[model samples]
Target: MAGSLWYATAAPGPVLGPLTASVRAEVAIIGAGYTGLSAALRLAEAGRDVVVLEALEVGERASGLNGGQVIPGVKHDPDILEEMFGPVAGSRLVDTVASGPDVVFDLIRKYEIACAATRTGWIQPATSPATLEVIAARVGQWRRRGADVELLSAAETARLIGSQRYLGAWIDRRGGTIQPLSYVRGLARAARGAGARIFSQSPATDLEETHSEWRIQTPQGSVVSAMVIIATDAYTDRLVDPLRRTLIPVPSFQVATEPICDELRQTILPEGQSASDTWHLLRYFRLDPTGRLVMGSRGTFADVPVAVAARHHYRAVREIFPQLEGIRYEYHWGGLVGMTRDHLPHLHEIAPGLLTGLGYNGRGVAMATVMGRILADWALGMPGPELAFPVTPLAPIPMHRFNQFGARMVIQGLRAMDGLARVRDRWSARSAPGLSL
Candidate 1:
């Protein structure tokens, strides 16, 4: 499927080897993705001797494999959170996610990270009338909460995106884009520079309480740590049972075109706006500096080359702009996203010295990095309130085992619904005289 695409086009990078001997540290972190690396960087900077154990090299997984859309905010709506967590906690969560991009960009600038970071902004384009209403409501909620957000008219959105397919959209300039793998690698290098010892291919096997401290048993050796952090996300192992129980792993896929002509590229999201369609099974796209169209979706890929997935993505490109067709595709790849039932991230204390953070849904680029900083602060004996953001263990979804199977069924159902909605919209557009195309 599309999974094979990533293997063909991934950048040449070092793959970490297995841990051959035992080691020790003050704090041992599992998984070297954004969350773990971010945590390690912050801790090392504070003079904490930290050791990060990774099953693979840094940015070997989703951190390295994504569409590179650095959009901000949590996956769920703010009102939905408020209804679920009460006004106080909900508002706090909203404020945290809304400002996450700033936190990320500031870190990049401060640390001199070489990732191709940009504040090009993002647009949630309404694909249909129903989805248009949803987008409009989101714009209203963001504005009401004092977010720097704007709702565009059909003409304004067309002018901005050079596509008339989207009815309208919600634009948030604070949300931007980045080269994901480079950013993750840069973070790891910074952490190492700050005195953190990061061991690749050292996967933690067992995390047990040893007296008052924590012992992380890895394939090569064991480290006795004052505290331990697990930030593996979807690749989270059975090292900790509670963590597996809290987060659900889901697969996400992406495809990239070779490069478009300057004229075509300029007319398609010319403002450097990352665009996502408003559908249950959504499509997101952005242009890389090389002029490649990196697009992604939520479903599994069929027996297609990276070119086929690229074609599918380009088809999506064509749907938005009929002007673009027959574009060449170069790469395709997929990654797993660890998610929670409520679409919120999970941070829980499984034992006295063991802590876990996972389930970023798909907003890991910014949220995961921010969470890493929070994880380090927690490790350094800092109080939760003292940390810039909040981290709490959410109640595990009841019958989570069954929910995994149920999740696939729900996705299939949503895909069907999305198809039906598209048909209905096309019919309405054809029959209604007052509906402007």
Candidate 2:
């Protein structure tokens, strides 16, 4: 099987070469994912000289490896965000998050990016009655904000999702899906078109700051710029040790089946939307443009083989859609998601003229694109107070080394809890008088 179905199916990407000599620009960005490329495009279009150095080819990391769900907003709802960050800051954040999908779709249109972009919506289904309250609460918050969101009854969810297991769901119309790798690659093409210099295979190994400028050293060349942006999310390194420490990079694994029969394709995700369930160890699935069913979940440790790692997802696919039994899985891949102590995305001004945008906590497609634009705003001289996201201190996570073990344990416990809850919910429903499936 292909390591990544996206890679196998993606159109030819832009040809970007490695850096061979030192260059100077107004701003230098590290990492060539959505964040760096988006920031580069904006900065370059603003007539600023920008240089982007990437250790690998564009979208080779999290940006390319993600599940391609362009979901807007963070894990928290708008009301909670406002409560946590105070009305003013939180409101700004809410607005920023709400517009994330807008930014992504706009870019795709403005740049004419071809990634099989779809804006049908994103569905978060309740696996059991216990999760209905949470889903309804989330729907209520978005509806109160006058957002394009709605709650779906169990029948509607089953019809839309082609799954009778779900009790209900909530959907955000602002959410969508994309060919993640192609999207990032197109961003690189657009950024270059806007006059940005991008170098693939150019790792920013050393960073030194003088009185007014920052110098980044790569394997074959270097970049000297007035300001620097660290856009690496889950693939962070020691280039900024503190920044690296602030993230818990967890692997997210995915599997894709060969194109299903047209009948199955029409039944599953028929509205062309994607879905993620409410399980503690959540399961997210979607249909690609080719009709392949893609399923994703939190990954096993690195040493596990792809087939072995895919056991859980295979089981999930069977339970979620028994009709897909005996389908052939054509691909498997994984990437890291940078989780912060606080599930919120952070924008940090590390020091004067040195800045960074935080990880998206798995909401990278739209959020990362917006974050890149935010980084560009900072580089364009926007004050920290005026930026959409609040600039907070970068504090390393405590006992971060043990996060992997904890993540594993959490996954196991959540799996057990979700299973028990579903069993109980099924029993209660069966016992309820006059209730029918």
Candidate 3:
């Protein structure tokens, strides 16, 4: 199987050469994912000289490897965000993320990106009655904030998902999916067209702050700019110690089946909406434009074999969609996701004129795009109060060296809990009158 289904499917985009000479720009961005590329596009559009330094080809890492779900909101609940950041700032944060998919689709239209962009919406299915209540609370909270979300009954969810495994669901019309690699590549092309200098295979190995400018050093070149934005999320390096330590990188593995027959496709996600269940170790799935079923789940961060990790996802697919039994998987891949301590994205000003945005948990698609714009606005002298997420100081995680061990333990615990929850849910269902499936 191909390492990445996205790489096999997405059309080739622009090929930018590596940087070989020192350059100066008004702003320098490290990393070439959605956040960096989007920021470069905005900054270049504003007539500022911008340079994007990428360690590899754009979207070659997490950006290209992630499931293409364009989900809305950060990892935390809306009400919790409101309570943590207070009413005004927290509400703005909620609204900003709630509109994330709109921002993404708008960019696709404005740039005429050819990524198989779909706005059919996203569904969060509840695996049990307790999870259904959680989904209900989420739907109500978003609805009260004027979001176009609805709670689905058990029958409604089953009909939509073509699976009776879910108790209910929360459907958010604002969410959708995209060809992530193509989208990121398109953003890079747009940024270049807007006059942002992008260099591939040029990693920012060192950074230093001069009296009034930031100096970023690559292997073959260097960039001197008034400000710099470190947009590398899960792929952060030792060049940015504080930012790297703030996130625990976890592995997310995915597999995509060969295109199914049209008849079978019609019975699976018939509405073409993306869906994920409410398990602690969540399982997410969606149909590609060509009717291929793509599913993903958590994997080990260590050097565990890919096939071993993938067995879990394969079992999940069989359990959820028995009709897909014996289907051939054409691709299997995995990438790291930067999980923050609080399960929310962090925007921090490491020092004067040096900013960093990372730690999206797993919702990097829309949130990263929105965060790019936020970083651009901040680079353009926007005040902290005006941004959606609060700009705070970077805080390194304690005992950071043990993060890998901790992450593995957490995944194991979550999986065990999920197994127990399934047993309990089935027991409760059989005991309740008229609830047995």
Candidate 4:
């Protein structure tokens, strides 16, 4: 795996204890990424005995390798969510994910975690007239719900994003950015401080229900608990066949330039808002604490040279901001994003005493942390009817291996279409007036 900017710059995490013997806890969580660590913190703070078993060190997966944009809400808009899940459940779901950034920043302030959190905002810039309409609908829905969101004109969008490539954008003030690796490690530290036992290098080899309690078998130890929470999103393995099959892991790649001069830093992402364009194969860009321009996009499913993998991102920076020319990239990394068929995050009670919360699409930083709290709530006896998000059965996609293979071709096709759309929109802007909401 490539070393990410987060791993290269974030503070070192606490050393975890080894799991060499059998242990019993009220709840056992698998995969100590954002979800598991978040749940463990809440559970231990609530005076429950929680044990977390991680395959590797904390934040070694998506939680640590992500773009660090703490974007609020899922892929679907608020009204669409209500229509899809029905009025009551839909409304609750809307409120839950819409406050995702609040959940993350609140945890940071509460725990005093030093992750370089910035709440300037998150921007979704439109690449063409069609995407401009999509963002307009989203802004209207959110504004009606009393969210602090606004629509930006072409000039305003260009100012904040430091790019003339976008015609406009929708800004959500509640969204922000953070040092993701440091944040996840901070969560682990807080969970341990609150009386949770976390063990690293402990992969849950097998999980089975013996009698009424669940036993998770690892290499050198086992955990017997009444409730089991599978927080492993994209890194899920064969420990539970049905749960793993329910998600498709799509690889997202990112690269960061070496810290630029003060002049360049002041001109790019001037207000500190992270922005991702509206495209089928979208590209996101942000500035790290030290002024490194971080660009993220899709990476190939198969391994290739670092330069080859980061080729698209390099082109993005050049096309969007000509001033960034001659800047050298310093870091490149990739991680799998758990994408669902419907693009909605799934919460499943796969079996008695076994539950999972995954398929965050690309909004793992905020949504995954929200899932942790929800998982803790469910373990604390929250009934299904009272929960905001609906819990459904795991419906594994047919020919899962085939879908993963086919996604690569689909990504290439989208890339071509996106390029054409960009060129068309740029020509349209030069020929006539730009589009409006």
Q: Global lDDT of each model?
A: 0.75, 0.87, 0.88, 0.88
Candidate with the greatest lDDT versus the true structure: 4
Candidate 4 Cα lDDT to native: 0.88
Higher-lDDT candidate among 1 and 4? Answer: 4
Candidate 2, residues 23-120, lDDT tens digits: the string is: 88999999999999999999999999999999989999988988999898888878888988999999999999999999999999999999999999
Model 1 weakest 10-residue run by lDDT: 428-437
lDDT of 1 at 269: 81
Per-candidate count of clashing residue pairs (backbone under 3 Å): 0, 0, 0, 0
Better of 1 and 4 by TM-score: 4
Predicted candidate 3 versus true structure: per-residue lDDT over 1-437, tens digit per residue: 14888998886778898899988999999999998999999999999999999999999988888899999987767898889899999888898888899999999999999999999999988887766777788888888888889999999998888888888898999999999899999999899999999999999999998888999999999999999999999999999897899998888999999998988888899998998777878889999899999999887665777888778888998888989999999888988988888888899999999988888888989999999999999999999889977987799999998976887887888787777766675523212111110
Q: Sort all candidates by lDDT, best to worst.
A: 4, 3, 2, 1
- Which residue runs does candidate 1 get wrong by more than 4 Å? 1-18, 301-314, 385-391, 394-396, 426-437
Question: Per-residue lDDT of 23-115 in model 4, one digit per residue for the tens?
Answer: 999999999999999999989999999999999889999999999999989888888889898998999999999989999999999999999
For residues 1-437, could you state the per-residue lDDT of candidate 1 as single tens digits? Answer: 23433344434443346666667788888988889999999999999889888887788888888766777787777787777667777777787777788987988898787777889788988777766777777888888888888999999889878888878888988888878877787788788889888888777888778679887777777788888888888887667766676776766767777778887777778888888767766788888777777778774523334454445556666776677676665776777878776667766666766766778888888888888887887888877655555567646667878877776677677666666766676512221110110
Candidate 4 off by > 4 Å = 423-437
Error of 4 at 32 (Å): 0.4
lDDT over C-alpha atoms for residue 328 of model 2: 97
The alpha-carbon lDDT assigned to residue 338 of candidate 3 equals: 89
